[model samples]
Target chain A: MSPTNATPPSERTRVRRVAQRGRYDRETLHAIVDAAYVCHVAFADEHGVHCIPTACWREGDHLYIHGSNGSRMLKLATHGAQICVTITHLDGLVLARSAFHHSMNYRSAVIYGVFDIVEGAAKAAALDTFVEKIAPGRSREVRPGDINELAATTVLRVAIDEAAAKIRTGGPRDDEADMTREVWAGVLPLAMRPRTPIIDAAPSGTPDYVRQWHEIASANAAV
Target chain B: MSPTNATPPSERTRVRRVAQRGRYDRETLHAIVDAAYVCHVAFADEHGVHCIPTACWREGDHLYIHGSNGSRMLKLATHGAQICVTITHLDGLVLARSAFHHSMNYRSAVIYGVFDIVEGAAKAAALDTFVEKIAPGRSREVRPGDINELAATTVLRVAIDEAAAKIRTGGPRDDEADMTREVWAGVLPLAMRPRTPIIDAAPSGTPDYVRQWHEIASANAAV
Candidate 1:
């Protein structure tokens, strides 16, 4: 259902530092986007370059974002301005025997491209994709966006063609001479954990998604 | 320990959409930075614009970043290129009664400025501050960076004068028309949680930081 193969890197997508950690395969890129709830998008305008964080989702080979029709970012993207979107998950802190060798365990994806305005039927369909992503069966329960509400919003998507994923895992790599130092070395892991759901109201029964949110997240972390 | 008051916003730092959520106080800015382990930096180069994620920490009224001297971002930053640094903590997903009103609860700080290179003793001291932030007393235990190691790294810091923080919390705000709909509405809260520490080696006893990592994080989340 996603991009099936890796694409050749463009001049901008090539990873220069720690090149071995770079990945170009679509599978790697898709997994990174799927795990994230938001991404930081960078763009340049008359004032200067700006980086803004916003909710994002993936469908096939494109990454989608929506905002008020008056949003400066959406307005700029609709004009075909180039932009960079990045998502990062900080997994842990890597502790080493030497200060110089300390590092972080993380998974990150960077995508570079221009966004195209999604309109008409496809725009409505895309909104459904986003709602379904956040709360599986709840999309059906919620009142769908009215014509006026949908008209007041803008939806945009960029192809995930020129993207790269970089990942670092495992323990710290300390110099041989420093390894014998009397220090406790290891990793202190971190995760985006789901907490107890705070219900505003539930005239209907709690859906499976809300009921199992914390349990599913805990199980995933254990793996 | 931080900027004492809120400063007037520059043209680029002002929040335009949903302006009520904007925050300008230094206390708010510093808290957002302190809670983050990383930030996405956006800078434009000859190749085009880029958004790169990197480790970051705060000290006084400045934010500091360090990297290998050969890093292109570091090299360009040292030359005084204008950049945008943004740190965001995703707190929860707000599920509204209607699809149009779904939103995310997050705390985000966006700073705009050029970075100044850090050198000599100040650079070394700043690195220690970073290490201390990650693991309180571990700085004294690890073998300090040697002269050569210090020479191979580049440190940079930017003034936090031109910055703004935006935050949203609690339950979703549904339109009156949609509120009576039969949808389970509220927030599905999320947090960056600490898992059990994984030890690679322990020649010395486990420090209080490592021993209390999960407990401390869990307590903070409860608040």
Candidate 2:
């Protein structure tokens, strides 16, 4: 369930002051999350605290995370407790004249909420959802998880609540007095593009599902 | 103070595994941390737990981290509490025959220890150490932090106690039976490289300190 205090529409987080560089809208946040593959999940434990970085996939307003059943974070989350989920994309390196001014241009989202473990049929469906998120349409192509494997894995669902997205983009903004200094200043965009797919070495024709999506991603990028 | 049981020579956390896919020796681990620019620091608090991804630098077996004086994690660490510091580099995607087998090749290290705040002159030294980690000789080239700025920042040090490094590299290992499958399978090397450095807009000749390290990182890559 979403928290009642989840960021209000107007209170949504954005890059303050640098209006041109921030995006507070939900669509922008979702697009950033959709394009990324992993997230850093942080939580506190009795023995201090820890953050675990792992792969994740989103469906609607909920995020699904999987880990070994023995993982401390997973064990804690399974008890229906609040956790922090952050997804960050480092867009570029901001080289400033001043070392103190040196910073990174990045897009990041922080979500805080209690997570509920998906069990029984719900767990099975969630796994399928994760499969499709990684490689669209591949969910149905592979053999489903067997009972033993499924029982051994843990999947936790965190409802999107009280989330804030912060971003910084564009060329370096040097101090006014330093504007005319003989220093180069511009942006070097960083993008993660999919390379040729590494097919598994097993014996079988390329799965139709994999081929279809590969073609789609290529076409989208070409545009 | 470090936890008595936490000082293991080699202890794998959730992300660290010794499987054929997740193994790294001490040299590889140290090299990865030395070259990394930022690390994801995770800690827990009364309002659940928080993970803030921030810049970090290491000296010997200890890591130095600084943040806004008001940061909750900084407040907690200053009390000499245990914390988790992690550095992760995502090398590339691992496309597998099945979606479940899909993974990312990465190099990561996790250290568990209690943090001690650096104050007075020791704090200034730590700041210099941080700069040197990023640009070996550049700390002296730039103006040191003044009283106000230094006062506004909080720095904490965590000794490397229980630590482990995990790495996944090389080409994909598909199922033996899938060897003849007409699917592509190989690694697409991923790397972070420096483009032309953008100088600040102010007029000053390139600092010799910055120029000296230009060629030092030609062979290294970031995750």
Best-fitting candidate, scored by DockQ: 1
Could you give candidate 2's per-residue lDDT for residues A1-223 as a string of tens digits? 2334334533323333334544445665676677666787877655556666787888787777887787777887787666778787776566554445556777877777778888999888988887777656666655567787688788887866566666787666656654554543444334454434444453555655446535543443312
For model 2, what fraction of the real interface contacts is kept? 0.34
At residue B73, candidate 2 shows an lDDT of 68
Q: What lDDT does the true structure give each of the candidates?
A: 0.91, 0.64
Candidate 1 — which residues are off by over 4 angstroms? A1-4, A214-223, B1-4, B214-223
TM-score of model 2 vs. true structure:
0.77
All DockQ scores:
0.67, 0.29
Q: Candidate 2 lDDT, tens digit per residue, B4-30?
A: 333345433434333443433445556
**True lDDT of residue B63, candidate 1:** 91
lDDT of 1 by residue, A1-223 (tens): 2335878778998888888788899999999999999999999999999999999999999999999998899999899999999999999999999999999999999999999999999999999999999988766888888999999999999999999999999998989898789999999999898877889988887888888875654453434
